[model samples]
Target: MANSVFGITDENGNFTIELPSWLHATPNLEKACAVKVIQLPLDSVCRLRHGPSSSHGIHLSSSEDGFRTYTTGWIQLQQHDTK
Candidate 1:
């Protein structure tokens, strides 16, 4: 596990999280933690992004049956709505 840089949580169970300088620049927090965009292709959102494209990474995808290149897990989950 990653070493905790900050102190423990308070009585209210609130703790401060100071992200890295690179994380601060990232717009999407979810994608920020997991994705790393190398050799950036045509992105509809970050087309005008500055600095090296390798600095940012693309989203990950997997096949349900381990055959296809792209996966629709999130979309399928949304459609099924098991909740």
Candidate 2:
């Protein structure tokens, strides 16, 4: 998941997306399309080790098989470091 994007963005927030040779682009995504990019909070990320992760951000069970079916719980920030 990490180290996927490797391009410098200009001041206008525009950059060329060059995927590695190992990665493949889906036919539908080959052309410019409206993509939904999600950025999870630092605490919600599993590697942060904030607390006992309950189902990774407490999602609601849904019949949809896609990620849109999942949702995160209320943002709960701790006052101190976990370490």
Tell me, by TM-score, which candidate is best. Answer: 1
Q: For each candidate, C-alpha RMSD in Å?
A: 19.7, 12.0
The TM-score of predicted model 2 comes to 0.26
For candidate 1, write residues 26-83 as lDDT tens digits: 5554344432223223432233234343232334354355332211122110122244
TM-scores of the candidates are 0.29, 0.26
Error of 2 at 34 (Å): 8.6
Cα displacement (angstroms), candidate 1, residue 70, comes to 30
Instruction: Rate residue 78 of model 2 by lDDT.
Output: 41
Candidate 2 Cα deviation (angstroms), residue 69: 29
- Candidate lDDT scores, in order, read 0.34, 0.38
The TM-score of predicted model 1 comes to: 0.29
Model 2 has a clash total of 0
